[model samples]
Target: MASSEESFLARRIDAEAFPLAVVDVLALAAVLTIGVINHNGVEYLSTNTVGWLLTLVPFLVGWAVAGPLVGAYSAGAAESAKAAVPLAVRAWIPGSIIGFALRASPLFSGGFQWTFGVVVLLTGGVSLAVFRWLFFKLRG
Candidate 1:
């Protein structure tokens, strides 16, 4: 059993973890914005709130899966960028592929290709880097 001091420390650690969760949500929002732009171009901003809504699920799933492995919730405790990058990539790759496929489908008619795919990949990668850097700066 843990003592009161230990419990307090544990709560403190948990409190520190909240920043990482915020980072993950921000990263997801960034990626979703990129996806919307790629799919509909600048015109997306002018019309259709539904497109934005459609992006929420994948963003949540991607963030939830990748955030823990990449230490997005643990601040400076990630093993290294080298360790975290691959995990972020792994989490986003499948979602990107699916996004591309859906974009290509007749149901939507927005052409998907390497360009948007690359954008999504870069967005995910850059998000990890930025979050990691912020974590170090803020906590380390």
Candidate 2:
């Protein structure tokens, strides 16, 4: 059995995962925005705000939904990079799929491209893995 102090400390550490999720979303948003600019030019962002959101929101929603489902927010994920990085990458696979599905849907503006999906999978996975690894290193 755990003592109260130990349990409290564990809870404190676990609570930090929430911020990881937020950062994951932010990191992916930046990556997605950069991707948009790379293909459509920077002016596209300013002139087509709705189009940008249409591009952005689905991925964010996908990550938000998939992270918890994949145990990305569990206490183990917050403990170290060895744990978090794989979880982050595993979470990204389904998250990207969901995002691609949402983007291909008629409600959104973009259609799914295999190349785009591959790029997002790779970039998002790398970004999440790097960030989660760095986050644990820094937290220590």
lDDT of 2 by residue, 1-140 (tens): 99997765554346668878877887798889999999899999999988887899988889877887777887888777898889889989999999999989997878998988999999999888887777777888
The pairs that clash in candidate 1 are none
- TM-scores of the models, in the given order? 0.54, 0.85
TM-score, candidate 1, is 0.54
Residue 66 in candidate 1 has what lDDT? 47
Q: Give one digit per residue, the lDDT tens place, for model 1 in 1-140.
A: 99997764453334455655576567767767776777678677668767675555544665565455434444333544554445455656665565556666664545666875787667866775676556556665
Off by over 4 Å in 2: 1-14
lDDT of each: 0.59, 0.85
**What's the count of clashing pairs in each model shown?**
0, 0
